[model samples]
Target: MNPDNAATMVAIEIQQPGGPDALIPAERPVPSPGKGEVLVEVAAAGVNRPDVLQRRGFYPPPPGASDLPGLEVAGEVVAAGEGATHLIGERVCALVAGGGYAQYAVAPAGTCLPVPESLSMAEAAALPETVFTVWHNLFERGAAVEGEWALIHGGTSGIGTTAIALCRLFGVKAAVTCGSDDKCAAALAQGAAAAINYRTQDFVAEVQRLTGGRGVEVVLDMVGGDYLPRNVQCLAEDGRHVSIATQRGVTAELNIMDVMRRRLHLTGSTLRPRSTAFKTALAEEIRREVWPFVESGQLRPVMDRTFPLREAAAAHARMEAGDHVGKIVLTV
Candidate 1:
């Protein structure tokens, strides 16, 4: 583990975006930290849906973002660049720009957060991406408040589970939709007020029933398209629906009448495309509002599985399977 050694590292690369087979293992030089960044000896990296999309070539990293496939990682800082005074040799979990799929990754100093003492490296790796996304969408954009009702699609997902836990901690009531009974039970155990099995029940109707026909105040949706119209229908007046991904479909026949009648606001965003300044602000918010909960053991990341770094392709395959209850990690 000499800092000066240019170690051979294995990374999952996409030769041609298509399916799970596209994620091929390759040997490459370990990257060095640049100004205001730190080079981490990655202990673990989280496998996210965006990584899967990137592998398929449907989504490419934003300009200056990492060309490799990882979005978040937890590891020990092996080296720090100029101006990165606080992070040398520190164990941390960070929201990465790219390059997380490798054995080593460089992260901006400001986006790195101290790992909770109680968390495993695998759990720490799982936190940054889903926690950041949920915080940004639910509290920042959706303005989910105490006592307000929040609806989340894919309730058993990493983001969904994180959102449900945070909402419970903050006194927000959450109703989530999952595909299976076991997933519903998992979401409920994580503090979702109600869980609807989407395969067996109409989520809109179930939400209506759960909320006493008033609808929820916020909706965090990843499945777009058909969910779009029903998301509007399941909103209270002035509800905000934030779409983070279009797993279902992008386009939808929106009933403008529902939009006008409910005054619902539909919005969406991607984390990688945001400027460093924006990401810094998000980091600050997490530090101020969320980190304490993590530090105190009130909010813990849900990790369902882990794969060795060399098994990154298999990790991606697991995520694509869509049966996982929480985050998946690649242990380096």
Candidate 2:
């Protein structure tokens, strides 16, 4: 590798997983594109919950994935691997297995999506991970549809904001729960028909009241633990409850009778552990169904704030504080 080329790259690494302090900056060689890959000179990277978990040692990188923390990136493609066409020096955003926290990262050819002509690199970086999660959990598995009611927990989160925008674009009525009145208002502004402040309000009763006792058709829940039982109770007949994370805790006792009697469907998944083929299929679906909305400016990322790449620890701290209304980004 040329010394000048090698000198251009930087990365954040975990010396030992623990807390925000674990993210340490270091120099790295600019990676070369391998077969079926493209080398992106990252302009920005999205900060996600999984990055926090990874920094805490609670989540490990999947096989063949980068050991660094970032899961998504937006940048110009600087180099293309052999057999990779249709992309060269193109501004793109991609869902990567890892390596997004670096100044340079490699993305599989199939996973790269054209950055919307309307969005900045920072805004584009925020889309792939959150949009992929929302589409898969809410529409694909949860079977959410137009004119149906969808309830999202953590409504002020990156996932929540994206879900709200997507539901609105799809003509679905959306309700969400957040931590405060301010967060609730933010959620509502993002297209949530109703935003419940979980700290001061009862989400179940609110959902029932909002829907006139019918409840919502689908609940996208990230808060597990005792919320699980109440979540099932808040579901409409034949409703689906998809649990994506256990922020509150995983194990919970729930009434099987409710599930059987209501004919409900309960399902959930994590994206990191999934196969590349699965992600490729998802990327294609996003391109076909969701990309147009982004292109037309109907759906776009809600960026809370951005920090320089060297300030990754501060970014992680802000996310951990739960003060953000949307995605936090690291600009390279």
Candidate 3:
């Protein structure tokens, strides 16, 4: 918050809407956190799907957020604004709208959570975006319950892996679908009760067989083309279907009769553009309901690899390649 200490920091900027090479490293002024904010000396930042979209000039930062290409980071709080002074010296992992691919970034105080003592800075960096998202959509939106079956698509993604771990830790029965047998195996290893290889198996049929034709109580999906109607058929009576992303295509023509016949509840959300108060409430819910599982060692971050902060373009390329298993991180 001090003008004198607002030094310049190296960051990756999107010079234009293009490919990974468009991510150009440059120096930018260190951001000063406003009221109820904290200045993080970033140790590491997570590379997410949204970042990839942002790099391609598709997803822009939310209103009033930085145009930088990062959504989450882990580091120590070097300074705090007005009412956030208590967090000035604490180490934390924070969920942010942007500006994380750097040595220094600003985050809202309420979006920050203490980095677990057992986690390294890199692992901590991988938690915020995926964790907040999984907790929000799966547990909160899906209303996944103990002993109940939940199906997650893209079972090896950051969201999928985190969801699997949280489901296991919370006693939810998980059945996930991945692109390959290897990723399917990885999903099962992460505690999914069953892993379906979408490349080889019919996930709807598999889900039916896995749940004795009752179907899963909740279906978490990001793939939203024909998967939409098929996902509806994969749900149980009165089931909840929550879609967080549409990796295939956005618009889907659904049979209203099918939705009504199954009594399916359809929903979806995007985190970055949300209000700070909304994110603050989600953070509080995570602290109250999810922190214990993290502390008890039931949840651990699964990281694929770490690239230096300046090599953010490479990280984005790797993510686009879709070969990595878990989260890709950028270490400063």
Instruction: List candidate 1 stretches off by more than 4 Å.
Output: 1-4
By lDDT rank, best first, the candidates go: 2, 3, 1
lDDT of 1 by residue, 1-332 (tens): 32768677888788888888877889977887888889888899999999988988888998887688999999999888899857888999999878998888999988999997798889899999999999999998999999999999999899999999899999999999999999999999999999999999999999899889999999999999888988988998999999999988989899788788878898888888887778888999899999999889898888889998878888888888888989899998
Model 2, stretches more than 4 Å misplaced?
Answer: 1-4
Q: Supply the TM-score for candidate 2.
A: 0.97
Q: What are the lDDT scores of the predictions, listed in order?
A: 0.89, 0.91, 0.91
Task: Tell me the lDDT of model 1 at 289.
Answer: 96
* Model 2: per-residue Cα lDDT over 95-181, one tens digit each: 998899999999888889998678999999999999999999999999899999999999989999999999999988999999999
Clash pairs for candidate 3: none
Candidate 1 C-alpha error for residue 209, in Å: 1.0
lDDT of 3 by residue, 111-162 (tens): 9999878888999899989999998998889999899999999888888889
Clashing pairs in 1: none
Error of 2 at 151 (Å): 0.9
User: In candidate 2, how many Å is residue 239 off?
Assistant: 0.5
